[model samples]
Target: MKILIIDDEAKAQSLLKKLIADLSLKVDQLFTANNLLEGIDIIKKEAPKIVFLDIEMPEYSGLEILDHIDLEQYPFKIIFTTAYQQYATEAFKLSAVDYLLKPIDPDELEIAINKALKIIEQNRLSSQIKSLQNALNELKVKKIALEVPHGIIFAEPDEILYFEADGMYTNVILKDQRKRLICKPLKHFVEQLSQNKFFFKPHRSYLINLNYMTEFIKKDGDYILLDNTIHIPISRSRKDDFTALLRETFL
Candidate 1:
């Protein structure tokens, strides 16, 4: 496998390279480019399987790469690297685009690489990039992409009742009483939906949208009842925080 890293900062480039090495990915060739144009040139010539692209470039943002390269023709997965925070980062999650925040963590890098491999195999990179571009340009995105075995599900955040962990998979329960089993784990959703204030992880095995929570039971066990009439337990450690959040929201 061939991999490329594009970033203006030499330090960032070096750090990512070291991290990739630490992860021990099966990379036959590892390329680096200082800027977007250079990265484009490398892409055209080398055709790496994966590209760790820096979004905040001097001349062109990483999204601008879409303007240069025809993704349909040159189909390679992109793992965006960005220093942008809050709103901008939210767009990435909403679009189901893989991104690493600045001062990247090794675990995130590993996860992103694994995801890119799966997407490349499924040949679903083009639509994801299009959605990401639209989200960044518009600066507001309400829907999120959920990857399942058959295909991807694009759904509004409010439509989700809660996420339940089933070992390696996550069961996403919708308002319409549909359960979509996702390939990724619950922890992935927790991080992806962290910015969405309504979603709360009351237990390690589940993440629930607070808006769907209809009742809280304290006598029998710490559990929350959602509008869908499903009981989700609140972890002992998270009980105080969950109660406080409920008070803050309803009070």
Candidate 2:
């Protein structure tokens, strides 16, 4: 398993290398590139399985490196590292394996590496990269690719009715009332579905697509009734905002 770190700051690169070394990840070879051009060259030649990319760079943004590389030819998992939260949503839009906030936490680094390894093992790199490219170009991404235990499940946003939180996993309910349990949490879906105006998180445990919203029941904590006869609660704090949004969009 080859790992590459692409960051301009020597200190940031050194710290990341040290952290990876200390954690004893299954890295056969570790590579580093200071800028996007060098990183592009190394990526073309070496083809590392995982890349710890710095979102912000001096010459060009790390995301620009994707423009130069043929991801279908040399697929790799990206784990974006950034000092700002503003880029977190954009990073997720890229379908990155994970985004870590710097100065990096060892536990988070380990988790990100483990996720990348899983993705590499599944060989879904090409599909994820395609999704990322679509998002980067601001294209209408109709399908959502979800990684399940067996394989990847590609679903249309409209096919989804709502999401229910179940401990570490989320239960995805479709328009047909069929449910699929995924390893990702509800928050992950919230971020992924943010671009679609129909998906809204009215409560901590649920993410409902307004397209399927049949009724807003005001009794017993203000829950929403969906086409599938499923009821999702709206948090007290978010009820007013959610109702206002519903009125503005539907009424």
Candidate 3:
């Protein structure tokens, strides 16, 4: 595997190189670029599989480089490195993308590298890169890129009825009564969509979209009825908060 590090600071570049070298990752070529222009040129010439990008640069920000690349033609996994904590949310908006805080932790770096390698090997890079670009550019309605057996599927938050835990994977129920078994855990959806007011987790195994909810039934152990007449149970612990949220949002 080939790896490229794009950061203006010499210290940052050296640290990353040393860390990778010390860990003995299966990197055939380790390239470095000080600026966005140099990084772009090197990417065109070398075609590295993974890029460790720094958000802040002298001439151009790391995000600006995405605008220049044709993701479909040259698909590469990007692991963002930044000093700012605020950018974490933005970085995570991109499906399968990860961010490492400055003075990078070795454990976190290893995890990110392994995840990138797995995603690349599965041939899911192009869709993930496209999803990342879309997430970064838009904000009104978020689109989630779900990895299925064949490939990727893009779905809007409002279109989802609920998410059910299926062991390691998640079962996504849509408003049109279609179900997709995604290769992600229900907790993953909870973490990613929890920020949106319309999504909530009433139980450990379920993440329900409040927008698709039709009725809140308290008689039979506090379960909520969805648009398609699907009854999702609310955990005893979460029932109070769920009812409170329903009251605050609806009545």
TM, every model: 0.46, 0.49, 0.48
What do the candidate models score in CA lDDT, each in turn? 0.85, 0.87, 0.87
TM-score of 3: 0.48
RMSD to the true structure for each prediction, in A, is 19.7, 17.7, 17.3
Local accuracy of candidate 2 as per-residue lDDT tens digits, 4-88: 9999999999999999999867778999999888888888898899999998998799767667887788889999998988898
RMSD of 1: 19.7
* Per-residue C-alpha lDDT of model 1 across residues 1-251, encoded as one tens digit per residue: 99989999999999999999998678899999999999989989999889888888898877677878887677678888888764355436434348788889899889989998887766657777888897784443377779999999988888999999999999999999899999998998897787777899999999998888888888778899999479999889999898788788777
Number of clashes in model 3?
Answer: 0
| Candidate 1 lDDT score at position 36 | 91
Candidate 3 positional error at 138, Å: 39
Candidate 2's displacement at residue 226, Å, is: 66
Candidate 3 per-residue lDDT, tens place, 125-157, comes to 677888988887566347888899999999988
What's the ranking of the predictions by lDDT, best on top? Answer: 3, 2, 1
Q: Candidate 3's error at 98, in angstroms? A: 1.0
- In candidate 3, stretches whose alpha carbon ends up further than 4 angstroms from where it belongs are 94-96, 124-251
* lDDT over C-alpha atoms for residue 238 of model 2: 93
